[model samples]
Target: MIKKAPVGEIPFAIAGDSRIYVTAFVNGSDSLRFLVDTGASSIVLNTNSPKLKGLIHNGELADNLGTSGENSVEYSNDNSVKVGTIQYDKAGCAHIPYPPEYWDGVFGLNGLAAFNIEINYDDFKIYCYPKETLTVEDSYVSLPFTYKYDVPFVHLHIKLNGTLHNLLLEVDTGSDRIIDLNTPFVNKNNLLETKKPFAISRIASSDGGSGELKNVFFDEVIVGPYIMPKVAGAFSTLIFGMQSKENIDGMIGNNFLKRFNMLIDFNADKLYLQPNNFYYTPFYDFLVR
Candidate 1:
């Protein structure tokens, strides 16, 4: 018997800094992290990495425009990627012969659209809402914020070291990981140690310049009373676009959002997040204003 997926919940996972995590198998191997990127038209390597062999190939190169509007060349292969129990037949991706410098392969929207997914950036969690029942509370609510606009991100709060450190965080659905910081924010907080370095790769700026990749451990990241332990983040030194003028420490991306059920009510000046488990408090209310 063919069984249908449960309702209200989407099948998805996230990994890396703030990227969506997809459990995909390469060449009948175990599932691994496939970063979800909506902005990318196709997938490519950071520079030069062995993972290139994992991508299925049919001998075709494609031209791509990067985030900074630079032309990127790639090759697509016909490979089947398995996520969860569902297998995508004829799955194809752009193959980079070598990762640029410090880059990793991403599973962009073309790969993710195969499944129905909804993510709440504010809660640092994404709910696999049951397809059978759709809740009405998913609508937007205005939170008490100094800003006059009723934007979705204005209400999320940032917590540092497991404590509310009075830092501002922007919830970006477009981002793949939980938290990604700009150079200024990292420097202002003195968060990085020059002697220590970690290797990570992603899509670089249009100019083909290196994107800063650093490992970070926050004692805790708290938003609306939700706490994530041993969280990792990125510190980007490259100024790809206009510097983040929002003065935010970083962005809250899907890496964290895929963990729980969230309710955002902007009109009430509060955001609610309910944990999947009972040991923790179900409701987390935040006062943005």
Candidate 2:
């Protein structure tokens, strides 16, 4: 139920380098910030936000499995969420520790499943339209996506030591990482024995999930027609819930996603991309100076 989506554009801000979020009125009481994430299942309000006052809430916040590790969330019904030109009546959100520090929660892309969403990094705007309103073309590298639990994923080509292979990666806007290879996938490929890892780093989450990542380099990564050479890669230890899941190889995070102007057509189950100003910029490495 996309209650009142009125075709419009909303501006957003990037928090701590990679998380994209927007401020919205929560139950007409307070203006709260929420990270717009496709990987999120639904709206999850920050249980820590002081603004939680005035919003009718009564439930237990439960911990759930996540990429950084364990995550906690509580379900709530009959809420109102208004941001930009969209208003969601009878909104359902969860109470979770997300975005960290002083931010609110995550506004899941599943909430806007009825619209075609466009994200422009150049202007920092998110445009929403009624389904079937926007047009697509062959010029745009149209990548088809499959959904799992409301999150969208696509296959990417990874070249390791002259051998090219395909891996299904979750297009996760919620993560700051560029690429994180899951344990099973890494084990299946025997990457640890074959590749030289340059560094080991710890990745943390707001819900207290943290683990070490072994850093390596992919000889080449193909995103549509664009080729990224010597891309930084993280092989997960699989401590996190999502990382331990089988079948999927890994996730492509916001650091890589920000390089393109994207349009996600939920109706068509497709993601269209064009390189933005940040495309040629270097990928974030695991090293800290």
Candidate 3:
């Protein structure tokens, strides 16, 4: 028996530096808070979560594949993912050793790919509709995206030190920083040897892994037809994690994304952005002492 999941709206709360958390039901368990993360490949349950304890019954032991260093994890098809009344039967969940601090688990894009997901930052609500019912407002700008390793990747250009650099970046709604350039991309571009100075900051990944990166300022970042100036960016120096991948350049996080109302249509492989009240707000540079 298939339950109806035509349309629905999930309200989320912003906590701990623009992280979006929503309520979800997992494996017939009670409702628990889960972060709405487009960066995550699949539904990841925290082992430390009180409500999610012992949820990985049929999971198989495997290496935890994250941008960060590898650890052990359990991947199981014995679970189900649910948001409000919308249930995902085919969706599988993973149990990671490192748990999230603020939420019960992380809600990845695996199941969310079934709909046209819209996030209204101004209203703190996630509205989902059938892909066939997608309607784009005149105010929205559309950009095409491709799925790479279960996440959405988009092409954009950045101008730094009077040079134009075209790169492919991931739309990572889960991260709070503005931009994080991968290690290989930074090395290839000779960013560390630049005349401009940068600050060093220690960072942690979603799976409780730790790494370090250099924080720097960006002159201008061009996304689609939008030009954002004076943005904060990072040069990842981590030995492992998503930041070390050679195939991609970087990722755009919430600090850059909160400026717009966004929509992600997985079926059409399109991303839409519209300017909101938060667009003009000054960027918060955490690296600044």
Candidate 4:
């Protein structure tokens, strides 16, 4: 017999750039705003975060690679972390460099692995159900994914230069832009030759790095059963320097995902996409906003 799982609902607020944030209590003391980042592997706390007060530091060190470069970070263990009615004891966390204004930390997939998390972008709420008891609706399109270094990767078919190319993309909810391509994929496919001159723009990386990216209109981008036509993407070398065991082709960010109400089950290796009311909404250049 399968065990029944508990259900929890947490309210989330949208940042100016459309990033989702939730307030979580650390060690039953300080409450901090943590970005709900699916792209991140582990829970990351800013070194300057006030919530770091009572956590015990562990001697393990890790390197976090971003658009700028790599930063060496340390790990810590907290007695308990409370998110809504759910509590995790002896939670492992990464202590990284100071985050930007209005952001204290990142709540990643490792922190939410026990539950099947549903991100209701339309309602600004997060519904979490125990993985065993969670039931996916028939309207949802289930996409298969593989986890590497605690990050989720999915295969997407995108039409570039009238040829359909299968690309492996990271589902990055923490990113504001629609699509960010890596250098190898861009060079191998000769994407620059077909770029739109008028749509080129400079983009700022999340780690305070900056690079040039050109927007290209694709004939179609198919994610699971959904088809997005005339999709816009930013081709850049921003992620070329990042260290990864897998050869990642690019990333799929919030601008492309916001149109759907998503459910990500990391433990089960499944992503469910249900098109919301804004499914057909026009895509804007959020990087410039």
| lDDT agreement of model 3 with the native | 0.77
Tens digits of per-residue lDDT for model 2, 1-289: 1224438877898766677889887776677887887777777778677777546477666555577666566778777888777788878877775444657767886466757888888888888878873566767788899986458889889998798989899998878888888888888778877777788878765456777788888899898788989888888886457777777888888988988888888888888998889887766533433
Candidate 4: clashing residue pairs, number: 0
Worst 10 residues of 3 by lDDT: 1-10
lDDT of 4 by residue, 180-268 (tens): 77777887778787777447766554344566777877788987777888888877755434322238777888878888888887667
Score every model by TM-score. 0.44, 0.89, 0.89, 0.86
Off by over 4 Å in 1: 1-20, 27-31, 43-55, 97-104, 119-207, 211-289
Model 3: how far residue 200 lies from native, Å: 2.4
> Candidate 1 vs candidate 2: which has greater lDDT?
2
Which lDDT values do the candidates have, in the order given? 0.45, 0.77, 0.77, 0.72
Evaluated at residue 189, the lDDT of candidate 1 is 65
Each model's total of backbone clashes: 48, 3, 3, 0
- The TM-score of predicted model 3 comes to 0.89
Residue pairs that clash (backbone atoms under 3 angstroms), model 3: 67-241, 67-242, 68-241
lDDT of 2 at 159: 93
For all the candidates, what are their Cα RMSDs to the real structure?
A: 10.0, 3.6, 3.8, 3.6
